[model samples]
Target: SRPPSEEGHSVDELCPNVRIHEGVNVSNIMEVPFVVSIQRRISPNLFAHFCGGALIRPHWVISAKHCFQQQRSIDSYRIVGGTIDSEDTKAESSEIADILYPDEQSGSHDIALLRLKSPLTIAQREDFQQLKLASDVAANKYHSCHCFAAGWGVDSLDSGQPMRYLKRARLSMKFPKKCYEEHLYHTGNFPLYEDPSLYHCFERGEGEDRGVTMEGDSGSPVYCHVTDGTGRVDAVLYGPVSFGYYPEDANGVTIMADKMTYTSNPQIHADWIRKNMKQ
Candidate 1:
């Protein structure tokens, strides 16, 4: 749902939820592949919400487990592949056969695998390519990698409604141990401290011109730099968003999902997808 404002402006026009006007890093946006939009439209009511996701295999989608924890039926969820456009983008939409999540519910190991009824069709664009997944990203190799996250989430934290055009930002990778230290968690199910297994951390420049992750951005992909060999995406899904710190300071910051920490290993989830989607 969009946020309300006293001035009566459309949700996308308000601050924090402001629209991504033309001429804002559109070039880099094309370089990312495997980005997805998670959409759901319940019957009787036509309203919808968009979250980010990534395509691991042609039929398997890696996203946050929490994204579908509330969904009653798989029919309600739709995976939109192949475009970051906010308003009108045609994608290889697929019905979700099943959603796989962890039974223990650890944030650090928070991940979900969506099995599509069918594989996706590739688009011809050179910039659009499949993404890889890394088993381990060494702490020493923190290459200041440039990455991006796209969604219809609010531009700022306070004003709400959804944005019109899909928006993206440049992010730098963070070490898992460093993330643990910065988030202040010393093992054992810390909600505030992201689990290092299923998530990775990234920040904007100086935290001054900080890029934000807000409502509706959940389950979205936080992709690494295009230049990276293998172009492997940081998999794990949604981690700590602005609210994890302070509610009032909306759009305060977000910590991404750690892919290796594993509440449930992605490999197991991948195996489930392969076995289940075929059935």
Candidate 2:
């Protein structure tokens, strides 16, 4: 049972429910109730929590397809929710029962869905609320708008290690060309960055609040608020965080300070998503 709230909650254009270990933490569990941690159960005593995801339905989740590239099987993965901190093991959890995605055409399609072993009674959980899948209209409406991403990625610009707390970062939709020019690892015409079906959401953190997604953030939801003409803003899921990079400028040198994040276009896969759900 997923209950979606208004587009932009007044307290914040919120991000994945996060708690920052350092700097200003912009997100919390209540703000982003749909966020979840996807983990891999390597053995009886060991586990590797690798990525972030959004709960779209009680039993359905949205995440980056590439997250499963090394996925062994349904039994090897798990989903944890109802908390902002991944280090906390007391959160509600479930085993991933199944996973599905489209064949890749050179990274054009990076979105995937997971089936939880059991339904998440979202209505019963105070800290867990599912996000509504944005319509094509909603997606277009929030274009370049203030969006947020939450996950357990790197803690600092220089750190590659995963943070213990969920982190929220501000971002906006970027055009394909701008994405290529500003966010790619290089200036060359990369097909994935040029693909219209994907959205390049960029975050160059300013001041004390640095907003960026890192290595472990793949499959995290990239979302925003969709305001109806009447000013009612409903939180909508835009896409799943796909990749992040620092692009080069005309000087042929990479800009280490600027971070570019890409998300799979949920609007582009709406039809397939609906059809796949019934199977």
Per-model TM values vs. the true structure: 0.63, 0.78
User: Model 2, which residues run further than 4 Å from truth?
Assistant: 1-27, 103-107, 123-129, 136-145, 180-187, 205-210, 229-231, 248-254
Query: Candidate 2: lDDT over CA atoms?
Result: 0.70
- Candidate 1, residues 1-279, lDDT tens digits: the string is 433334454323332321233333343444445666777875643425556677766787777776766746778777776655544445567788877764445444456777888776643454455554432344233222334565667666556766655666544456666655644542344445345444455555222223645677666666543222233333232232222222122464434322212112354344444565466
lDDT of 2 by residue, 16-124 (tens): 2222234536356776778888888768845666899988777888998888887476777888876777767677788888888865564578888888888766525
lDDT of 1 at 270: 45
* Candidate 1 wrong stretches, greater than 4 Å: 1-30, 44-47, 86-90, 102-108, 123-127, 136-144, 185-198, 206-210, 226-279
